[model samples]
Target: MMEKIWQRKTDETIGKPILEVFPELLDQKYPELLNDVLSKGITIRENESIAYIQQKEKLEKFYLDYQYTPLFEKNGTVNGIMITVYDVTNKVEARKKVEVAEQRTRLAIEIAEIATWDLDFLTDNIIYSENLPQIFGQEKGSVITRQKIKRQIHKDDLPVLKKAFGLALQTGIYKYECRIIKPDAEVCWIRVHGKLFFDENKNITKMLGTVLDITDEKNSHQTLMKSEEKFRLLADSMPQHIWTSDPLGNLNYFNKSVYKYTGLFIDDLKEQGWIQIVHPDDQKENINSWMEAVKTGNDFLFEHRFRRYDGEYRWQLSLAIAQKDEYGNIQMWVGTSTDIQDQKNFTDKLEREVSERTAQLELKNRDLINMNIELQSFAYISSHDLQEPLRKIQTFASRLSDLDEQNISAKAKTYLGRIEVSAKRMQTLIQDLLTYSRTNSAERVFVKANLDEIAEEVHSDFYERIEEKKLLSIFTL
Candidate 1:
């Protein structure tokens, strides 16, 4: 079968040496493999070799994988080599492309400063990327062992790393953030993400992960926490009520003043507890306004009455402003409630005093008005009654004067003239008094009056009486 398969032309061609039949095996590339199989009497051998060989019509280059085994004679001594060939050109090309990809990936990892690691569970060997030294701040070519990496980890973080790794053994996932002391003795934080590989029996076979530097992120968080603590301390030190709420207007923090004024513990004032401290009359309006402000992220200011610890409702001015992020999203509402009870009390007192004084002035005005009306009525009645009596006296005196003076004694006639003159003077005095009363009693057009003109009128009436007196004087002498 072997002779037929090789198509040997004669028995001598079948028993000849391998190189005598296939001379292409004489290349230097396959020298070691040829020695191991043909000269060393090896039991079995394998190798990959390339060669140029004559084909049906042309010479071609071929990549071949060969398996060589020694054939034994009847006496058990090695006789010749038996060979098997397989073409592996495509496999070789694929392997070269894989190597190129790996090179590119390694370059990318270095540029990104990522520290990649693979740990073989069975051998307890950890293979780290070339960039591991840079991440750990270690010198170039420094030895990196599992124990050395463990030593670099902070004492407080070692147990955390171990626990996360242990959990990965069971869960096939791992994540951890820990601090490590760098080669320069400076501490830095790192975050690690890992995936665990399992074998058929559910045993851990390997772990693959990457580490990232996170020192900047860690420091920023610490600073923010410290700033918040300081703000809380300052707010608690104030006497006025201070509070904070989320964007939804749900209260989250209240200062010490809030508890002191309301006489309520923090636990007691969790949800809507602030409403209880507000006076019942003001709660609805206050809550509505606050909700509107929160929905719109606008500032709010209002005054309402709040119940104090002593069960007294006092006026307070409540103001709140929304805290916002750079994107204009509301983060929280910071607010203060200041006492305005004293100012409100003062304003009430002032208003009461003004109202009382206004009432007193109105009462005095009405009394003065009533007195003027009564005085006007009395003046009218007195002027009417006195005019009738004066007319009767003048008429009777005239009639007496008309009685013939021839029939009267001279002394009697003189007395009658004097009586008439006195009656007329009394009438003039009454008219003057009436004019003065009318001036105060009613509205009148006031013209410029000369006192001398008024005196001259009265003097003329008395002058006529004086002439009559002169006549009487003549009779009496």
Candidate 2:
């Protein structure tokens, strides 16, 4: 072994002096140690002692377990030094590598705020990492035991912890999350994962586990729960029927108003779906519209009749919109159904009334048209038949007046004049009446009329009456 380690031939080292064979030992502690052993007549030994030697003109390092013993003769004197050596370089280097790796693992555990523990049930003792005390909010160097650790656990979680241990004994696996109270009275959450070890007798002998602090995660979860509760309360307070569904469009939640309006329990709605409350005639269209919105992740809108709690079907305007996450992924759907039954009834009544009124107005319009036709016929008769007789009377009266004065008496002539005046007035009045009727029936054409001409016509028609009454005339121009 020495020859192999020194990398020299046995012939070169076998009978040589120690200093001559290993000249490199002159500057090392081996020479001094050998001399001390010889002088003291004693034996000395070292294990895994480091040495540097020159081999083939190169310096190389080695670890060795070596011994130096003084050789004794019968005179009670040491005559020479005996040396023994064994190489241990490989074992020492491997051990050093293992130590380095263990150090790295410990550092990683510390950085991650994890604590490792080993519980020996046989001894009822615990061996834990250096940071365990700090995790429990105890002072450094505090002795940790199973009982102490259990004491730190929240009282409410003791039963759960016990159950987990019992299960771990049966199943060889242990996992639990529970709250722990620090020495300073601050509460924190912890998650424990462990594996159980048993003896040949099937009795638990040890447990190995890691503990991690989860207080922040617990607080965040609690905040989210509170926010969801608030949302539920707000939804329930609203008058409209509010509901929510998962991303897959499965209805999961309905507010108080929905229960009040439909008179159905949550489980009933969940099992049968809220669509069961829709009027049968509207169910198909409602399902179609809702499914289309879900498949496309679009807003939903539909007007349908819903069966109310009292068994009356009322019109509802239902609307839904998708709620999306920051990544634009649909998270859920929120929906509302508003009662528009009164408005719908009012609109239907108005439309009916409008139809009835329109029909009545059309009938009245037809009656007025017939009446206008009768007036036109009357005007035609007045213009023709009435004027022809008046013309005859005036012509006969003129003929009479033209006859000799001796043939006609004064009283008869006066009656003839009055008859002629009356006939002329009747003719003029008939003409005016016909003109007024024509103006009403025909599209009016505006034309300039001489006021003086109209006045002269009127004067000629009433000349005999005006002469008989001797009425005064006034005109402003």
Q: Output the number of the lDDT-best candidate.
A: 2
What's model 1's lDDT at 170? Answer: 74
Clashes (N, CA, C under 3 Å) per candidate: 0, 0
Model 2, residue pairs in steric clash? none
Q: Least accurate stretch of 10 residues (summed lDDT) in model 2? A: 468-477
RMSD of each: 16.1, 11.5
The runs of at least 3 residues in candidate 2 whose Cα sits more than 4 Å from the true structure, single-residue gaps closed, are: 1-116, 122-152, 155-160, 166-172, 182-186, 237-239, 260-263, 308-312, 397-432, 439-442, 445-477
Local accuracy of candidate 2 as per-residue lDDT tens digits, 142-243: 999988888899999999998998888778999999999998899999999999988899988899999999899899999999999999999999999898
Query: Per-residue lDDT for 1-477 in model 1, tens only?
Result: 233233346664656776776566576455567667667777554444566664445555666677778887898777777778777767876887999999998887777677899989889888987778767888877768777888889999989988998888778889999999997899999888989999899988888988878888899999999998998999999998899998999889999998888888888888557789888999899999998999888798989998888999999999999999999999889999999999998999999999999999899989988887787778778877887888898888778888988888787877777667777877877787677766843566678999877666556556657677664422224
Task: Output the lDDT of residue 369, model 2.
Answer: 93
What are the lDDT figures for the candidates, one per model?
A: 0.81, 0.89
TM-score of each: 0.52, 0.62
Query: Where in model 1 is the C-alpha error above 4 Å?
Result: 1-115, 123-134, 138-145, 162-173, 195-204, 271-273, 307-312, 367-477
